[model samples]
Every structure is written in C-alpha cells, then in structure tokens.
Target: MSQSATTTQNPRNPDRHQGLANGGTTFAGVLLAVTGLLSIFRGIMGIAKNDVFVATKDYVFRWDLTGWGWMHLILGLLVFLVGLALLKAAPAWARTAGVVLASLALIVNFLSLPWHPLWSLILVALYAFIIWALCTVKRGHT
Candidate 1:
C-alpha cells in the first residue's frame, strides 16, 4: 500500500512534530500569520499615499488604491485571525475557515497583480501553499 493511505508518517524521520506527522499545519499557521502582517503593512502603505506600490495606468481593473488598500486590510485582518485560530488546531471549523480565507487571498493577490507584480505573485504562491497545507491534513492529525 502507498504511504498516505496507510499512514501520515515519514519513515526516515521519526520526529513526529516535524514531518507529515504534524501535517505541516503548524508551519502553515505561522506563514499565514506573517503573510497577513505583510499585507496589512502593504495596505497601510497604499492608504498613506506611499509610492511604494507601482500601479499600472492602463490596467483592466483600475480602481482607487485606497479601496484596494481597504480590501487588503480587511482580508489581512481576517486571515490573521484565522491563522491564529489554526494555531491550536482544535476546532475543525478553523481549518475550513483557513481554507476559505486562503482562497480569498489568492483572488485578491491575483487582482492586485497589476499593482505590484512580484509581491502579488509571491503572496499568491503563499496562499496556494496555505490552501494545500490546510487541505492535506486529515482531521485530528494536526
């Protein structure tokens, strides 16, 4: 039988807290928190008229940067809260919420790609990883 069907353990690493034994949820939680914080900072910068973000002029989805900032701020706040909730890995609902929030993050990052290409793409990748991490874990495994 394959490994996943039988067990969630790494044969090479007996350290339960490190590998799939822990489902990488702990790492996901921490990364999500950091990503949220970064987004929050980016939001503040956009709201403050800081020229830190380079927005495209002739983009298809052009809008007031302030509005985008607000979206980022709200999304980041929710993501941060969900990340914190995932820390305990107690309530199953937290995982569900995390997955949902990660999906939203992906969309937000994709939409903001014209504003900041590299960072937005990076965040998209992070959100994808978060979604993968959240989805891979079996209930009660984390």
Candidate 2:
C-alpha cells in the first residue's frame, strides 16, 4: 500500500491526536489548580497561626508551622501558575513543570502528615493523580 493510503486510512491526524491529548491535559490542569488553591488556603491557615492544624510533637520531619506555611504558599502559587499555563496551552514544558510541582507537593503533603493526616493523605492522592496524568501523555503525541 502507498504511504499516503496508509496515512489517510489511519484517520488519526495531528488535530485528532492533539484533541485526545488535550482532554487529559485539561483535566490535569483543573486538578492542579484546585490542589494549588487548597494548598494556598492551608498555607494561610498555618501562617495565620490558626488552630486548624495540630502538629505532632517529636515528629522527625517536624517544621515550624509558619515555615511550612511559607513553603506551601510559594509552592502553591507556582503550581497554580503552571496549572493555568497547561489549561491555556499544553506545551511540553508545562507538562514537565506540572510533574515537578506535583512531585514537590506530594513530598510536602507527606511531611505534613503529622499535622493533618486526613487532609495530607487526600492531597497526596491528588498529587499522585496529577503526576500520573501529566506523565501518561505520550511524548510528541501532545
């Protein structure tokens, strides 16, 4: 068969492939944005010295609540910006940034377990999903 014939028969043009990829990217972007916002709120709570969180004493990874708060606030802002970028344009760099930020968020959440176990776990799960979504997209297919 001719190469042109094969290409035409496949019915998977770049547009269609990109559309398929966009679906996943869009979902990931939304999830990342939501997660970032949540992180920001958590950071604010901590920075404000709100009584919402309780840190376990003598936890090996323990950090000053305010310090963690600052970390979350900054990380959350970065995540939020990357998420927005992905939503607007699913560029390769955006995907990379998403994965990196998601990984960082996962680590932060893990360390935060002692402060808020349930919430931290939930964020951890969300970050994992974001990472999966970002990584699963085939390179050059997007």
Candidate 3:
C-alpha cells in the first residue's frame, strides 16, 4: 500500500528503474548474451577439436586454432557478463564497456572468418547491431 513497497527502483541509481526500460539497451544486452554464448560454444569446439576448422592457405591471419579458441573463450565470457549487466539497472560504465567489447568481438569474429565463415559472419553482424544499440542509448539516462 506504500509507493516504495512496490517500486523496483534501485537504491543506488534511483533516476531510472533500469537502462533496459528504454528497450534498446535491453535488446542489446540480449543480443550480446546470445552472441557471447555462441562464441563460447565455438571456442569450445575449436579448442576441443583442432581439426574442427579447416586450415587455410595463403591467409594473412593464419594462426593456431587453439589460440583462437582461447581468445573466443575469454572475450565471450566478458561480453556475456557485460550484457547481463546492461539488462539490469547497470551503470554508465557497462554501456561504455559493451561498446568496447562489441568492437573487439567484431575484430575477433572477422579474423576467424577463415576458420568458420558462416558463423563468423553471423557473429560479426550481431556484434555490429550490439554496438549500435549500446551507442544509441541517451547519455545520463542509462
């Protein structure tokens, strides 16, 4: 029966209920989480099965598949955690980090294209969208 009783406002940042309230941030977060999980799975595959990816010839970005796996694993975890943060009443830092992480994701996915063309491209697209969403959020609003 009291206003404070049912309010979902976070005690730390009471200006808004959540950054996700605007929808874009929430959507971005969801996308980030999905992409992160996908990357994680791909990383596991790469690390567990070195033969999973075809070795390329004359590729400028050639490298060990296992190495790529480790990169994906670490980056994916960071992206996923940041995305989760955005979904809540996250601070401004999360948005900034999301942009950074998504940019890095774009680079990683792009570089790994030789190994998994389709998935890498798909991830690249997803990361692009995530960047847009995170960037579009209004300043001082979330």
Candidate 4:
C-alpha cells in the first residue's frame, strides 16, 4: 500500500496576525485617519455654505446640509478615534466599529452625492477600503 503524505496544521496559526504582520493594519490605520480628517473637512464646508452642495434632481431626497454636517462631524471624530486605536493595536472591536462607521459614512456620502460628485466618489472608495480591511481577517483565526 502506498503511503499518503500527511500535512500538519500549524498549532500556532499566525495567519490571523497577517494583517498586522504585513503592515496591512498600519496602512489601514493611516488611511482611516486620513478619511476621518477629510470627512471633518467636508462637514465643515457643508456647514459653512449649505448651498454649495446643490441637488442634482428635484425628486431626490434633500436633507438639511447642517444636519449632515453634524452627522459627519460626529462620525468623523469616532472614526478618527478608532483609527488611532488601530495604530496602537488596541483590539478587534475598534476595527469592527471602524467598519460599521465607514459603512454609514458611505451611505451618507451617497445621499449627499448631489452636493459634490467627486468627493462622494472618493468617500465611496474609502468606504470600500475600510470594509475590505476589516472583513479580510478571519475573526477567530485572527
């Protein structure tokens, strides 16, 4: 009988830390922090001049630009905090929170698209990066 080779599993699986090991976490953290700063800037701009973000269509949902400013400001602050925590290797919860907040920011940006299409697109891309960074790591495996 021919013997089959047996593959041994890594008792101490380090793949979970691959993100951190390969500087993935650092890049993600820096990107997240930058995203937060950009959001804050956009929020301030929106607050300063509500009309700057003009509606593309009459039927589209329109919200008080000031209201969006507050929302973005709050979320930006939270995202910034989480980004800092990630840099410090705080915990998984921080990353998870970042993902959730990024997702929300994406939705908010989408609704606010009529205001500035370019910026909205940028936010969408950042949202995708945040989601990918957070979701790529296997929970328990990491």
Q: Write down the RMSD of all candidates, one decimal each.
A: 4.7, 4.7, 7.7, 5.4
After the best TM-score superposition of candidate 3, give how far the Cα of residue 92 lies from its true spot, in angstroms.
0.8
lDDT of candidates 1 onward, in order: 0.80, 0.85, 0.84, 0.75
Alpha-carbon runs more than 4 Å astray in model 2: 1-22
Clashes of 1: 0
Lowest lDDT block of 10, candidate 4: 1-10
Output the lDDT of residue 119, model 2: 83
**Model 4, 1-142: lDDT tens per residue?**
2222221234345553554543665667787788888878877877888776675667377678888888788878777888888788767887788788878888988887777788889889878877777766654633
Number of the top-ranking candidate, with lDDT as the measure: 2
Candidate 3 weakest lDDT stretch, 10 residues? 13-22
lDDT of 2 at 46: 86
In candidate 2 the C-alpha lDDT for residue 100 amounts to 98
**lDDT (10s digit) by residue, model 3, range 1-142:** 5767546454655435345445767888898888888878878988999998897897898788999988998899999999899888699899899999999999998998788898789889988888877777655675
**How do all models score by TM-score?**
0.81, 0.81, 0.82, 0.77
TM match of model 3 to true structure: 0.82
Clashing pairs in 2: none
* Residues 41-69, model 2: lDDT tens digits: 88998899846778677899867899999
